[model samples]
Target: MAMSDVLDEGPFFHGTIADLRVGDFLAPGYRSNYRPEVVMNHIYFTALVDGAGLAAEIAAELAGGDAIPRVYAVEPTGPFENDPNVTDKKFPGNPTRSYRSSAPLKIVGEVKDWTRLTPEALEMWRERLATLQSDRRAEIIN
Candidate 1:
């Protein structure tokens, strides 16, 4: 089968707000975003590609793929706890709270911002994969 043919095999996945977790994710560029019925904690995401040439293949076929979104996760970097330290003692209204990651996060976001990846983005996929592999270890029990 042609390399392009392999890319066409079906059974794509989808994500929704209910699947949101406090971690990093890499999602395929599909329109059915995991947006939930109701807004909740925000999630961070990255896009994955094999290499520059392979990336081009994915891009070119994007218009024809299943269009089903995909999501993979990794450990989150910030304190995910809800702390009373600075929370308003008296939230007269909804009392709902929200927290966000530190600003000036990274360059991957630039894709969404620019609708394309710059050469600098070349390393992002490799870096994210490495980060995800950090916890893979042989178990040792006594």
Candidate 2:
């Protein structure tokens, strides 16, 4: 079967520290949330609300101080592909439901009801991200 056939449809979400309103466009060329040193070529998002929540929490933590984590319902304006960082390198498939698009993603609305990570869970994610940051071999597939 073709990989695209198995992908979920609709209800995409994006997580970030930036406060965005409906109709805002999220485009490429911004610094990556996972690796700030690299400017991203594509905007990343996921099909799962919880996945977006996790990303937002991490991004907020990284931004530090008074930054709010936010998840938004979004629509891609053009074609998107599976995020190779997870799909090709780690998961061997699009299990994360992560995707990237060179085109802009339009914010449809904010999602306020997604589950938030507990302090311990957040800390664990922090540690994991820290380890990845410290590892010279860990690279974001820009």
Candidate 3:
């Protein structure tokens, strides 16, 4: 299938239900409740412009892997954080923001902080770290 078509299906909404792993897309707390635009915001801010690597990760995440865990998909959204992809949705814990990172497949992940981790910013960093980890894991999976 075409890459765009898979992305349209959604990171969690792939053609095959088995292609999606029900993992935590966000961290917990204020960050846990971020809109998809927020994640996308970081993507642009972090300059995550590589689609080749991301696409592969989505396929792996959809396959349900614990070792190399990560969500993968081409961020179809241009440069608009408010655009809201598909992953931008209120999860169970955090319900204050939207979701982003709409892919044909994704990996479930736990949230954790980076070096400067605080109670307030823990969720933020956690999701960030997890996304990075997910990205790396996606690489391995691919």
Candidate 4:
């Protein structure tokens, strides 16, 4: 489906380990958080705050540093499409509310009150990601 056809009004969020302030623009061309070997062509965001939180946590863990996970309220400066990585690939539709854009995402504010995963849940996710990373068929549709 074309990106313009999908209608969603979002108070969107982007999750990461990078510390950013309001008015910052998150652009594409960075290393993939799930597969660091690949440079991403699109900047990803979600309408779901907790999904972004999970992404942030995973990114922080993968980076293996003292950095804390952060989620920021964002606005896409241009058109976006459903994230093919998850949409229809894993779920039938966009239950994840995830999207990607080649254009920059402007940060409106930092989201400080999102729920955090517990240690056990975090570990489970780590294991799952590790397995996905190791599987040869689990390619990112970059």
Candidate 5:
């Protein structure tokens, strides 16, 4: 499947069912109840842009992880705060972008298993991240 088929905009979100559902995509904000270690608005979604990485993330957050994790096909409606693609820890927590959806995000579907990413998928993900990073840099430069 094409990355555009699964992704609506710049990138998709890889997170637990509860967090995604609870977080308001319409007015995306920080989670008050997140783990103490996590910053107030440092929401870490995936830049994986594929099922394999998404499923792995979902399983990691859940107990047992027997059931499939939900994948949120979200668009980066606003400017992203952190750079998950960046190796440097600009912030104390995991590198993630804090985004507010410009439009309503849709629940694309669930990843049933830890699917393996095809070579094409991996390449697409890398390219997409590069584009996003470049866009962010442009935004800063402007």
Candidate 6:
């Protein structure tokens, strides 16, 4: 795939209102862009392309009354790559680009902020991130 295709064929990241411990791999639900259930909860493994989108989702949930919306980094399993229904789009209420992976993704880790990354988690995230095509590496490096 071309660089743009990699950028677009994302196991794109998304932030949501859920409580999960680091290393937990539970399937989570996120809003979908499709019609009928315009604001439906889709249970799929997912992640943002970068940290900004995750932070934005946490902020929105906090503003909407969720006390502690934790951020988890999602890495898509290989099966999701070829799925035709997967999508990446900007949705209402969310502050950044959001995505929906129709297949289960692994929840590699969680963090209160980018600066709080544990060494182990950071290393693991580096591996997971290597699978994406984002231009936001500096966000995690700092």
Best by lDDT: 4
Off by over 4 Å in 4: none
What tens digits encode model 3's per-residue C-alpha lDDT throughout 20-101? Answer: 3344232212211223112222221111222222322332333444523222332224322222222233234222222233
Which candidate do you rate higher for TM-score, 3 or 5?
Answer: 5
Question: Which whole-number lDDT from 0 to 100 does residue 129 have in model 3?
Answer: 49
Ranking of predictions according to TM-score:
4, 2, 6, 5, 1, 3
Q: Which ten residues in a row are the worst by lDDT in model 1? A: 105-114
Q: Go through the candidates in order and give the clash count of each.
A: 0, 0, 16, 0, 1, 7
**Root mean square deviation (Cα) for candidate 6:** 13.1
TM-score per prediction, in order, is 0.18, 0.94, 0.17, 0.96, 0.37, 0.41
- lDDT score at residue 101, model 3, on the 0-100 scale: 32
Q: How accurate is candidate 3 locally (lDDT)?
A: 0.28
Number of the candidate with higher lDDT, 5 or 6: 6
Deviating ranges (above 4 Å) for candidate 6 = 1-4, 8-13, 26-63, 81-99, 114-142
Candidate 1 residue spans exceeding 4 A from truth? 1-115, 136-142
Candidate 2 versus truth, CA RMSD in Å, comes to 1.9
Show model 5 residue runs off by greater than 4 Å. 1-9, 19-39, 51-68, 82-86, 90-142
Residue 50 local lDDT, model 6: 45
Model 3, residue 68: distance off in Å is 4.9
Which regions of candidate 3 fall more than 4 Å away from where they truly are?
1-68, 77-79, 82-142
Comparing 1 with 3 on TM-score, the higher-scoring candidate is 1
lDDT of 4: 0.92
Ranking according to lDDT, highest score first? 4, 2, 6, 5, 3, 1
lDDT of 4 by residue, 1-142 (tens): 6766555788999999999999999999999988888899999999999999999999999988697999999999998999999989999888899999999999999999999999999999899989988987999988
What residue pairs clash in candidate 4, if any at all?
A: none
